[model samples]
Target: MRRLPIRPFAVLATVGTLVLTGCGTETGDPGDRPSSAGADRTIRAHKVMQLTQTHEETGMTLLEGPVFDEDGRLLVVDVTAPEGKPKVMRVNVSDKTFRAVRTQGQAAYTSAQFSPYDGRLYLTDFAHGEIVSLAPDGSDPRTFFSGEIDGARMNPDDLAFDRKGNLYVSDSRGLREGEARGRVVRIGRDGRTVTVLAKNLAAPNGISFDEDYQGLWFSELTENRVSYLRLDGEGRVTSSHTAIRVDGGIAQTDSIAVDANGNLYQGLHGRPAMAVFNRNGERLATVELRGRTEGLESATNVAITPGGTKAYMTVSGPGGGFLYTFDALAKGIRQSNGG
Candidate 1:
């Protein structure tokens, strides 16, 4: 068995709050229905293509968190590298060219997102417990936030920002399970206040906001289940429910992404498959990975392009890590970068 650089047993500590903004806007309403529930509910499999062999070329494995940049380049983290080493790579989706996006020697980079407000990328450093900000071209790297929040150590993993600029992060706590150590936090746009939306999660690995921006969804990796939470006017979680529970098939789930139509995609780590869920949390389809190298052994993360035509996913195994691109049945929600 192969081990990823980021341990699955770590946890984080902290909670915060801030004044809610734009509560009644399109991105603020939590009343959107979850599923369209018609022909859109089922998605057929599409063509999957392996883009590059960077991991094999550089001996860098354990890839995670892929987000498309404004230029349509995908930025992913190579978590196996050490501190002070360059760990993020920008890949050109068209020509299959890639290069390291230089950062100021931050710790291991895990997940990254394009911030619409600053026109910058926010990345999660697994070793430093901080969020590092840098330009889309990977310049002017700086620590956006670090250290304890609300008196607890903040180990941010996968993160996403709401339209209002509030950041939500999953503190995997080394991917510990069922200990209540794992937590989800919302950071205010002001960059000071924090709010604990959900805690005691069993390895909350992947998180995303609904298309309506009214609800938040996350997957408990070890629990083999996905969950949904509705937020109140104050950005506090008002209600929660189990979205989907994988009773069989993939054992562990990692990162996830959602499309504009509320279709959810989750990477089934240790398996060559990705599961799709409708807005109502029903299992809609299962897209099995088909690659030249015996399929994707470990699908770590999934991201859809802004136009929603292609869905990019990261996979790793003993052989190496590879980026798999395929035509998506549904259109993904555009990120802050505009893809």
Candidate 2:
């Protein structure tokens, strides 16, 4: 693995919320849909291409959270590096070029993505129980959010964005870790925290909002299921539903992405595989990884381009790393039966 300098925020102590934003409240009416981020428009689909291996031709372990930037660079979290030296890798899509985005000792990033509001990359620091925000250029990486360091309750993993600019961060902790049950939280812009959503879930790892902006969808890893809930007025979770059910979440249910067409794509844990759920919560299709090795090892994260044609996923190889692109180059994206 490549080595890089690390930048970690030194922890002082837990700073209790000055004022909590969203907490458990009365379920509001279903009319609480906020204004769309932008005028409704169609998301054009593009030809999907597989990302080539950056290290050797094969055999580099996966880097977490493979997401794109405005400059066409794919940023991935390299977690399996030497202890006290986890880092982010930036891969240039144009020529399969790559570089370390940031470095961190004592903190391994589990998941990451670029904020639509700010270009900063928000990545989960596994060791610190906090979020790391990196400058758009990969400089000035520092602590972004955390409930408690080494605190059993908050096990932040995967995250997503809503039109309101708030974030949906899920805790993958199961019941055994009583402090942290599998739940979803809505983090406001001002860093105000609130458990606006959630309950007893399996491994609630990945989450996403529907195109209609009326519902929140998440993946339950252990249960091998994809669950969802409709939001009422005031951004409160109203009705909980299941979008798709699978016997096994092969990829640890790493990440998820939804298209304007109402189709949901999920990255599995170990297997280099991606699952699909239609709007009606129907199992539409599953895309497996190509090439040698054990089935696209780490389909860690999934990303849908602005156009929606290509579905980009990460085949995170810790022993060896590579980026796998699943574009609709030959076959077109199938229709879904989801709501």
Return the top candidate by TM-score. Answer: 1
lDDT of each: 0.62, 0.53
Q: What is the TM-score (0 to 1) of candidate 1?
A: 0.80
For 113-228, candidate 1 gives per-residue lDDT tens digits of 88867778888866568888888888888788787865776667788888777788887663533465678888876677987888877877778888787878887777878888
- True-structure RMSD, every candidate: 8.7, 11.5
Clashes of 1: 14
Expressed as tens digits, the lDDT of each residue in 1-339 for candidate 2 is 432111111111122101100000001112222223222122222213333343321113345566667665567765544433336777666576667666545454667777767767787654445777888788887666767423444556677766565677776555233222577777765565656488666657667777667877787666657788888755788788776776442234545667766667665664555656567765555565444543234555555455444445555433245555554212211111010
RMSD of 2: 11.5
**Candidate 1: Cα lDDT at 67:** 83
TM-score of each: 0.80, 0.73
